[model samples]
Target: MATSSNFFIHTFLISSLTFFPLSPSLADDDTDKPVVEQLVDTLSTIAGPHPGIRKNHAKGIVVLGEFTPSAEASSVSSAEHLQSASTPVTIRFSNTTGIPDIADTNPSSFPKGIAIRFQLADNSYTDIVSISVNRFPVATPEDFLGLLNAVAASGPDTPAPKPITQFLASHPAAKTFVEIEKPAPVSFATQPFYGVNAFKFINKEGEVNYGRYQIIPVNGPEYLTDEQRAAAGNNYLFEELPKRLKQNKAEFILALQLAEKGDEVNDPTMVWPETRQLVKLGTLTIESIDPNGEQFAKQTMFNPLALTDGIEASKDPILLARPSAYAISYGRRLSGQ
Candidate 1:
């Protein structure tokens, strides 16, 4: 007999199929209803609605730190936030999915989240939101919603080649994303996060460079073995970070993978070639976990579009859709819904 956890996982996989059938109709509606509303509605259906809760990555811890710019960084962008001696930073680490209490060891929890906020000299702040996975499943917001809707459409009673199968068949990138193995990290500090969307970096000379952000752990990446995974607890990732931080600071190198002329900046689903140059922008040293980390994580909203001068969002539709989707999520949480 399957355990409760196994049952939940099985049900979730089937329920996800319900989403695909709804996608085409929603995509064609062209209604004045904000895309964020539709996105949230779709997410709520898949994750199950929970008032005062985030639609995804619901469990997380926030840490306070300072970002020290690299001497070499001065050549990349003239953004004042990056030029400052030291900018205060807030970083949040979280598991995947909106199921708040999902087991950390679950396969559904593979692609974790890392959201950062840099407090600038003028008291303004900018955010960089990333995930453990380098590539996104879909290129546009419409397709992402469609993908979710496809998953939601699947049920235990649905046919073997369900809507999700058909959806993945048409969306090759989505199929690849689903098929990829995203192993659980031993700890949040051991994961390498990637900002899937591309951004424009403007230098002092007004020259522009397009690149994606990459956050690599200074201690290097680490993952659990099968034996280790079998022995870990449900809340191991959340529990391990605080203890680890007490022993030593966690650090990550902030770098950018520059895009060549032919690279597609508009599609986040298409990852850039690995041959691109990587420029070090700064180092993030997380000295300690915030005592009120959980509360802070619950209340704060990290917006990728909340950018400062010299850095701007790309033309990616999915990227453009993020701020509004985040706003909707923030408002719902604040209203205690």
Candidate 2:
């Protein structure tokens, strides 16, 4: 009685971020199209087409807030937002899958998402996009494309060692990425979010250090028991966020995990050790839910590469590919796909 949906849910829960390397021989006919377009297409194949929403993280709720920079923030980055002034921000919490109406309690929605946009002076903005799961699976778009193909080919009737299984066998980092436990959070405010990609942070004196972002909830992460999750409504996470904010502001510590010499800066799969130094960048206080958030969520796009001065993208291929993939999805959304 298994279904493709069931298979996808199981496989996707392993790691919503990406998959293993795909072989050229198995390339789809659409290979002629841009890889970004192919990624968008493959995501639709796996998650179904949902019009007027993002191709990934389609189901989300937007919240408004402000970011207060830490005293040490300027020591690591000269970015204007990291300076003395408080910056207004927009934050969106979402499910990993592209299915807009996916039940919040579903295992497929386990690794929740957070996208934070800081609005700076003169109409400039910077964004940080993260998932509750701390790392990414693949290094390049082609590898992710292959993983997507594997998942698309995997179904309930598929033979032993499904494509995803075989993929995990060949790719150790991806295997580890999928094996990480991801439980549903009691509420969006209760979860921690991580920026998996490394970035170059430049200080006022022009010194540079590679670091990854860790957004930890001030109260720390809290998960639901199976019984509680099952008893929760389909939109429980979203509904709970607004009500939580009304009672009091939700807060998170924004910090960077600095990479030591010889650390892998260009590979997202290579997570730096916990023993690495953590620089407290600032505090993000989410204050209110946007009444028009849903409409804004449909139209706005959050790009990790949409960075400001003092923050630059690493050469990580996955990080580099995100903007193009996001652009394709954004266009499709506007066209009512």
List the global CA lDDT of all models.
0.77, 0.82
Candidate 2 segments whose C-alpha is farther than 4 A from its true place: 1-15, 18-28
lDDT of 2 by residue, 264-336 (tens): 9998888888999999999999999988998888888888999999999999988888888888888999999
The per-residue C-alpha lDDT of model 1 at residue 288 equals: 90
What's model 1's overall lDDT? Answer: 0.77
Per-candidate TM equals: 0.89, 0.92
Model 1 Cα lDDT, one tens digit per residue, 1-337: 1244234433333222211112224345645666667665655555676778887677778898889988867677888767749788999998766678878887766578899999888888899999888887777766766666666555556666766778878999877776676677889999999988899999888889999999999988999998999899999998999899899999999999999998999898789889999998999999998988878877888999999889988998878877887778778888876
Cα TM-score of candidate 2:
0.92
Clashing pairs in 2: none
Off by over 4 Å in 1: 1-32
User: Highest TM-score among the candidates is held by which one?
Assistant: 2
